[model samples]
Target: MCHDWGESGDGAVVVLEGEVGWLSCSLFSHPSVYNYTSALSTGLNLFWYRLPAGHDLEQPIGYSQRLSKERERLWLQPATAEDTGQYICMLSNKSSCTKISMRLEVLARDQVVRGCEPAVAVAPSQVIAPLQEGMTLDCPDLQDVVKMADSSPSVTWYHRCQKFPTWGSDREQRGLSLQIHVMLTTYDGSYYCTVHYQRRGRELQYSRSINVTAVYPSSLPKHPSILQPTQDHIFKVEQGCTQVRLECRGHFPYLAGDWDIWWTVDGKKVEELNNSRFFQNNRQVKYDYGDRTVESVLLIQNLQAKDLNREYNCSVRNQRGFDTHRAHLEQEVPLPSVELGCGLGVTLLLMLVLFVVYHVFWLELLLLYRSWFGTDERHTDDKEFDVYISYARNSEEEQFVLTTLRRVLENELGYSVCIFDRDSLPGGTITDETLTFVARSRRLLVVVSPGYASQGSQALLELKAGIDGMARGGHLRVILVQYRPVRRQGWVRELRRARVALALVRWQGDKSRELTSRFWKRLRVELPVRRVSGVEGGGGGGEEGGSEGEVALRRLHSQNSTSSQTGLITNTVKEPQKVISIAAYL
Candidate 1:
């Protein structure tokens, strides 16, 4: 017996060695409704591949006398313990491609091995959930197997082969499902469940393995909240612009299909308003750590007087609750017309002055504004360091970080920075201390150089810790500083990935040494905003402040003369003539 044809799942099969084991594609399974035979008649092509994939990759299964395909079902005449990894069955054609993978655990009867006899199942044995949260595990696709037997489903759980982890709780059986009060990283491994039943006056078992990944809790599912088109946000519209667009964006975690973001105008949905000009379009983007961003755009074409008075709302909702942000269009205030006397010359001069002010003093103005208005990350969490510098010790990069980057970021900029050599406490394991530092820091500033990775394992450990923390959606964010050009192969895979995904700043010889240079500006933008007790305004104070920031840069510029190639690191990891721009996030 099989499951419904519409159901698509990946399951595990446990078979004893030397026994004739049957493997079926669980992409669409059915006993009599629709099976592989029916799929082939409908012009679908099926291919099988053994998993743990070969050197050539997901290659199709080769011909063998012991293995034969009868009515599109894979038959292992004498299953061996060597064939105990995963297997993928691909159902495809010219237009579409679908694949289902199954773990085949072939038990050897010759040895006293812990084993279970698994029957047919139709669901995937993979589970992913947030760490520290209570999670429940179920034996998916076991319904048919249990129903066929004349007994209740009493499941036994196994972790990492057959060894179970420390439960630290009451081992209460909750039907066929198991529950954990708090998910931990220690439980991050494969788990198998076996359920015994009576069939034909004989005992039988059904087993499956579920690979569990416990990610950081930041990506945990929650009620939808708006990211943009803030509450009662008003967008200014000009008299000549034909249309106005209002966009609302929100981030959701897992099960994005169950959530929605939409627009409503004047207490009615966009479709219910019955206005073609008020139509809306929605899009959902999946991010890493199982987070999704949903955006709803409300386009108002041929804007009219009534449209200005009407209220527009962008609402987002999940199973828990919903969040709505109201938006309104208001007429942009026009500048007062001036007589062609001295007013015109004064206006031009004023505009020039404003441009110079903004172009030259942008960083100062931004820092001042952030100090006053921006939400300080300090209050939100109890992180000790604002920045943690990861670099190769006893090298030019370390000198640059300790003497230049560290000094400026700590002394000039009011930020608590943690550098391993300078700040690490006495006597702690390298892995534990480095990982802890990465966790407690708000940002990791990786000074990438040729010597960093090759110098020792400690540098690589720090780099990996930072990347892992960021990937987990933990408190630490990463910022890559290309101190000097490194050969493509010299870079670690994770570091290369981090460079591609996170913000990257390059040192451009003496040019980037200036505080006013683009390199420092970009690097400063990624750093946590320093809280200023009082505003540092006035021409004198600003100049003094700028000069102070320039002091260490100038000192470093005079000290080290780098004779390295200034080039961009492309996806091919090849050295190119162009420089890589620092992107906060793509």
Candidate 2:
């Protein structure tokens, strides 16, 4: 008979009788209880193959059931944890066959979340470590861990909302334990754990909070600390002498907020101390308030011999913490005076001559230059900019310049472009006007030809102007391109030391894959794209931190070649683009 056996989980089995030719059983998920089969007698050794769901079993060609009197079931030699789910038993005789059902429940331990008890606790109540130094977190013992389903679960550790670089994810056959190590500041925040369950229907989770404290040596003075102009209490009385201001530096581990500063004179708090002011690390006192300042300075004003003997302490107080520092005045040393009519007069004469020459020549020339040309109009517009291409003439390298520009602007990002041409200069010296442009730009992209850096006067001047502009917070974008290789050395140091150059691109031209990958990495740092306004018919632009746009831009730039005019890079490498044509805008 064509038959099979029901799984043993729902209570089904096979029986054997003496002189019987064969007996077979059939089993499967039942529609009703009518399909249930009775338990089997002790005769045939039932070999049950337990498997996970979707387990692949190498099917036997024919069914066979052998009888064993010593053992009730056939011995599955050296059974593994994998052999622990559900199985079917096939029974057979000479003529026909008999079948039985069996179910295997693998006892696998998932995880043990330390319940009720805090996972970790510091002993000294407060834990402190120097900033950037190493620290540790103690984890509790995992002694009661047991096999829950049929396999063991894993223990994962995390800190500061970031995963620790070093971790353990390996599985052990016999035991389970873990030691979590962390470096301070590198790991400063809440910590938790999650277990990857081997069992089909169970989950493991645990969590705990940790407080990290950073300490520094000999922090700024706190409120209540004494402050004075001189370390020792002594000074000479003098007319028009600037007052000595007192200050207190606050303690380290500064809290994150504004703090109040105050001074204590002769055991009494001094109110309206005009010279004292609050600063980040320390309280400051100015001596010359009337000297010239829109805001009150921290310097003390007026000098008196009696004031030197007095004691003054400065202190700063914040809600989270406070600190004070003490100081005493010392003997005042008078400014040394040389023979006024001789040495001082000679110095005065020289300064007068130099000042007159500077005003007559340098100052006048600067004013003339400023009035003639004025500032470039580009700086008047308001846009946070990243780069500006500043390159000299190279008829041979024009193609390279244009290609690089398009790659950086259209294909790569959302930066504004201002291309300067010598032919477009308005009736003035082109060299002066170009220098003005380089100075106004945020970053200068210098397109260097094979001998561009070595080229005559004007090229060096443009490059120098670009360098000077960058010294005032502007960035430098260098694109050195040439058909013939240029050996970079000596005076051409920056160009030689360029992090990302088109020349390097040509070197790895043979390995296009690696070269392209490196080129994109360099572009990401140099040319970051801006958030684009969502179009009425477009799908994106609602994401935070430009992640949506970044992903889109990455997909666009991964093009293999410049083909169609649509200018869209085929991002077959990225996820299939969801081109949603929205009729409505948000």
TM-score of 2: 0.23
Lowest lDDT block of 10, candidate 2? 577-586
Q: What tens digits encode model 2's per-residue C-alpha lDDT throughout 437-481?
A: 665555555655465655343446556666555555544444332
Q: Write the per-residue lDDT of candidate 1 for residues 183-245, one digit (tens) a residue.
A: 777777767777676645656554566878766585455767899988889999987789998
Cand. 2 Cα-lDDT: 0.40
> Which residue pairs of candidate 1 clash?
none
Runs in model 1 lying further than 4 Å from the true structure: 1-123, 126-130, 133-181, 185-223, 251-257, 285-293, 334-586
How does residue 371 of candidate 2 score in lDDT? Answer: 38
**Positional deviation of residue 408's Cα in model 1 after best superposition, in angstroms:** 56
**Best-fitting candidate, scored by lDDT:** 1
Give the Å error, residue 119, model 2: 78
